[model samples]
Target: MAEVLRLHGVRKRYGGGASPVVEVLHGIDLTLAAGAFAALVGPSGSGKSTLLNLMGLLEAPSDGEIWLAGEPVHAAPDAARTALRNRYLGFVFQFHHLLPAFSAEENVLMPVLAGRGRLSADDRRRARALLERTGLAAHAHKRPVQLSGGQQQRVAIVRALMNRPRLVLADEPTGNLDTHTAQEVFALLRELNREEGTAFLIVTHDPGLAARCDGQIHLQDGRLIEPDGAGVVTAAATAPLTAQ
Candidate 1:
């Protein structure tokens, strides 16, 4: 399968100038295959957020290469990176982050508007289609305040899919939901992944949810650890990742 995302010897550091530099991620390497569903699991303060930021192109790696859709992007210009991010990535957080003032449909269209300055007829059509797919068609015109928590999250998920992103980065996507609702939302994500062929890298703390993924990436102290007896990547002394 083609790789949707790849990282090689990626590192991140902070606290320079006057303070000692702290390296958060240590020469990490990872790859997500197209249409694959994977969970990123680690304890708190394990650099999961930093790794996600690098993968999403929200921040550049302190060292090493990052490839998105086969393009090496770690050294790309800010404008170029921004364009690539809008073109190839989508993000969902624990909080829906929906604008309270906007209706569900409008929230879904936010990405398009932000990227293109205005929405076209096709954009509106796609938004409606995604809303329907997530069973939120009837709630499309309702504001976030009018929807239940699950409903609001469903809307957020639809918003993430508006651009048909190649990969979706979900950070604790169901963390705020009740157990039953979290399961339902997770099911929706799996259904969408299968139906749309979009790869997913979900940052989650739930062991059950992590185990359900095609693969689990474990992080300890900013390094990738291979799960015992699993056929996943062993980060130690690995070669630089190449597109496949």
Candidate 2:
């Protein structure tokens, strides 16, 4: 598989100077190969979300290097970073973040609309297809308020895929759903990973969901702990489903 994302000796600090700084990431090195589905698991304030933000290009690192699709991007300009993120990265947060006024299909097209100079017929078709894939084709005409929590979240997933991003960053994507709904969403994301070969780096607190991933990176107090070979399990290993 190809390397979709890589981070080397990355470090982040909120402030600077003596008594003027707090480091969030402590020389972290990580990578995600194309078509891989991985999880980041840790306690609150472990910096998992912070790491995701940096990886997604929403925040800049205080030090170290990052490469996306083999392109060095840690020092890229704001415009370049935004362009790269728009083209190669997709994000799904805990909240659906859908516009209640827009229909499901329209919401899914939001990214496509923002990227292109203007919306076109092909964009609509792609959005429709994405909605269909998420089992939301029948609900495409409904607004977010009209759909269940699961349905709204599924729309968010398709919207994230509007650009066919090389990497998908999900921050507790299933955190807001019920046990059954969370499982369904997780299964959907995994299916898309297999079908579209989109790499995933999900930040989740649920051990069961993390166990189902290709691999899980555990973090504590802003540091990623390398799991020992003995307890590590790949995505191929069947993980027992646990209630949320």
Candidate 3:
């Protein structure tokens, strides 16, 4: 598989030394291969969100290297970073964040339209197909307010895929859903992973969801503990270090 994302010695620090700077990440190294379906699990404040932010180009790392889709990008300028993220990285947060004013199909095309400033005939067809794939073709014309929580989230997933990103970073994508709904969403992500061969790095607190992933990276106190030969992240080592 291709290497979609890689991080080397990435670190983040807030405030200056004179202001009692607080270090959030400690030069962590990580990677995600193509078609990978992995979970990031840790307690709150473990720097999970910070890590995701850095990887998604939402925040700049204080130091180290980042490569996405085989290109070195940690030092890229803001505009370049934004372009790269829009072209190669997708994000889904805990909240669906769907625009209530837009219909399901329009929301699904948000990324595409946002990137190109307009949609093509092929883009529309692709959006419709994605909705159909997620069993939302019938709801394509409905607004988000008219859809259930799960359906709206499913639309968000389709929107993320509209750009055909090499990687999708999901921070608690299922955290807001009920147990059954969470499971369904998880299963859907897995299916898309297989079908599209797009890599996914999901941050999840649910033990069952983490276990269901192909692999899980555990973090504690802004450090990524190397898994042992058995590939288990011990409870002590898996606890989150910070909520910030």
Candidate 4:
């Protein structure tokens, strides 16, 4: 697979001044190839969410370089970064974060709406296809409050994929679901990842769910660790694994 993302010497710190500082990410380096599905598993305060945010461009890194697609991202202008994120990245949070007033179909079309105004006929068709893929076609007219937890999250997944992003960042997407529902959601995500060749970087706490991903990454106090390959280990991972 082609390399889709690369992070080198990445670092992030909070606070400045004489107190100047505590660092979370410490000169971390990582990469993701096209069509890869990986999980970020760590205990609370391990910095998984922070790392995911940095990858998603939701927050800028304090230092280091982030390459997306083939372009270096760390120094890109805000508009450029936003455009790139719109075109190539998708995000699913623990909360669906759907608009309360929009129907499921409308919610699914939000990213397109934000970037391109009204949905084209093709866009609508794609939205429907995604809804169907997530088993939410029947709920397209339903609002978030009208659907069950699983169904709402399914909509969120469909929304994330509406733009056909090459990379997806998910933070605790299944945190709110029951075990059975969470498994179902994970299965759906895996199917979509295989079918669409979309790379996923999910931050999850469930070991069982993390074990199902193609690769697993673990963090401790914001530093990346590969102890026993316990983190970022992959059932299908064939590349020489290294930690930096």
- Per-candidate alpha-carbon RMSD to the true structure: 4.1, 7.1, 4.3, 4.6
The better-scoring model by TM-score among 1 and 3 is 1
For model 3, how does the per-residue alpha-carbon lDDT over 1-244 read when each residue is reduced to its tens digit? 4678888878888998579778888878777777788889889999998989999998888888889999989999999998999999888878999999999999988888777898899999999999999999999999999999999999999999999999999999999999999999999999999999888888999999988887788888898876321322211222323446
Runs in model 1 with CA error above 4 Å?
A: 227-244
What is the C-alpha lDDT profile of model 4 across 1-244, one tens digit per residue?
4777888888888898868677777777787778778888778987877788888887888888888998888888889889999999999999889899999999999999888777799999999999987888888998899999999999999899999999989999999999999999999889999899888888888988888787777777777766223233322212222444
Model 3: weakest 10-residue lDDT segment is 229-238
34-79: candidate 1 lDDT, tens digit per residue: 8878899999999999999999998999888999999999999899
Best by lDDT: 1
Task: Tell me the number of clashing residue pairs for each predicted model.
Answer: 0, 0, 6, 2
TM-score of each: 0.94, 0.91, 0.92, 0.91
Overall lDDT per candidate, in order of appearance: 0.88, 0.84, 0.86, 0.83
lDDT of model number 4:
0.83
lDDT of 3: 0.86
Best by TM-score: 1
Name every residue pair that clashes in candidate 4: 216-232, 217-232
